[model samples]
Target: MASHRRIRSRSTKPSPAVGFTTAALAGVTLLSGQSASAAPGEPSPSIEEVQKKVDDLYRQAGSATQEYNKAKEAATEQRREVDTLLDQAATRADRLNESRRALGTFAAAQYRTGAVAPTAALMFAESPQAYFDQTRLMDRMTDQQQQAVADYEAQRAEAAEQRAEAGERLEELSASQEALRTSKQNVQAKLAEARSLLSRLTAEEKARLEAIEREKAEEARRKAEEKARAEAERAEAERQAAQKAEAACAPETARETAQPPAQDADPGSGTADGGHAAKADKVIDFARAQIGKPYVWGATGPSSYDCSGLTQAAWKAAGVDLPRTTWDQVEVGTRVATQDLLPGDLVFFYDDISHVGIYIGEGMMIHAPKPGANVREESVYSMPIHGSVRPA
Candidate 1:
């Protein structure tokens, strides 16, 4: 758009000439121009003079240089951002590796003990020392084991997410670099022809011009920092609110426990999660009926859905509200630990936190997988999980 302005041309040659204008139009086939000499309108400039003006404009218009410089700087910064993301991904990957080992060890232990069994009611004591083996740990898992699976899956998912973000940034940098290269070449060509004419402009003008650019860049940096700080404050406030709500819920849970044990783990059974028992009951009832449906990306309906979509649809059906995107939905609930996970929890996934799903007790979750995948129930351990929340 900036390049679309109508530039004033060496246009004197095309104007209607004044009285008795006798000028040789070099490329114009004119026999005598006695009758009508579109007399070199306003004093025809000599060809050489016109050439000089053109050369000057070409020299002064460092459009390419300006554009290329901006792109180059952006490319450099993007490289840094990409590098930072890569470093983060690598660190996550290492953690994922460690988690994998832990998961494997746990799996082997269960397998050797022949402790994992479907239709086998499994439970564990509070501590590893108080650990009890199961005939089958698969059907029902302890809160601790469920938490472990959630953590392991979360780490793996986080690593993948980070890698994907870094890869996208790399692509952006590559494209920027290519564009900058092309701009530099164009500027160089114009510079050669325009420099001779560029002398007409005073040094003060050039200096002032550069100063303006510097000011704009400074302004952009200030805006960016301001935005970052604002977002951080918002996140902190949300966290505090979640803490308050959790505190309030604790006593109520204690009261219930004094009367009857909380049966939160409902394996493959919808509407039976203990977590949902006390919260979002209406929403919980709606979501339970959608089990066994295939997932559809971004589709919102009774037939299929991705994680956030399914949650949104169910909540909508219950007259509650939620954001459309998982990232957006993350802020909608009370933050809770995996150890204290309950049914009807809305779990979120992130390295970037761009995905979300609903926890369905017993280490299982319902979600829509990424491209080419369908909506289905999967083990919380089957996918990387980050954290979860409940409607406050």
Candidate 2:
């Protein structure tokens, strides 16, 4: 592993009697009185600092992954637009060719009739029509010939415009492709830095860090479950209250058997309308199959995925098109409150809205977490909730 020579505190307060080296490589965490080493001999930095640094790097990687996804989406759209323009340009070129052939026939008839002057020729003149009209040569041609010449000129102009538009689209596509490359590199660099930091830790320290993460994940899951239960209970109470009010006001014969309020429609339960249930199930099915696939920064495929890529593909499998980044995806569907998130709703996280996952009800979600991890289910509350959207 590549190591950066970096000086970090051994402790908040170190023994002043010990000698310490000041500098190391860019990412190496040097301890007081001990040079940072990847070998087991180097004294470990505080577990807390290592954990924080790793988490920060992973967050940065997630941000870069979203950037990559956005650029990729733009590039995909730009390429499509460019292709459409190219097709239009080709069609225009064909039209122009046909127009030129019709005009050529007219010039041929005028040539054989000796109506066209030797010096005032149609083929060599800058303004063919003006020259023919000025020399009275157009008088010898049929009305259709005159129209053909005009059509040829108009077709040429239109073709030129189409070609120009195609050129501009190609330029935009090129820029978006470059941006995609930069975003991919940024993600890789951040992940590499995180890996380097992890490599410096001792085996016991690594195990402890993993334990800390597991504990946090469990805690988050517990809290999300608790919140979901509370929302369900609250919704049930409201439904009963409304039913009682209806019973008090209506005649016994006029009253219909009070059915349980539709749980699917309860805003607090985050369930979808019954009509969307089948599609949402399909989305969840696709997402679940992707579990264990490695989380590559910009991938959106059968083998690997970035956060948004996974959700986008899952929904696409269910015949819904989602934008390629969390920021844009959130805007595509109806906004849903956190408590109302149903399966297949996209749950965005973090203040920047850089991360997202597919909510699978019960406060769980399937997501491509970050580089070095795999697609898996975790609590929606595992990270700070920015918002939610139901991309039905």
TM-score list, all predictions: 0.33, 0.73
Q: Candidate 2, residues 79-136: lDDT per residue as tens digits?
A: 9999999888889989999999998998787677566564757666679676667457
Clashes (backbone N, CA, C under 3 Å), per candidate, total: 18, 8
Candidate 2 wrongly placed segments (more than 4 Å): 1-45, 115-142, 235-251, 254-272, 276-278
* Segments of candidate 1 deviating more than 4 angstroms: 1-51, 54-61, 115-143, 194-392
Model 1 lDDT vs. the true structure?
0.55
The true-versus-predicted C-alpha distance at residue 309 of model 2, in Å, is 2.1
For TM-score, the strongest prediction is 2
Please give the range of 10 consecutive residues that has the lowest summed lDDT in model 1: 18-27
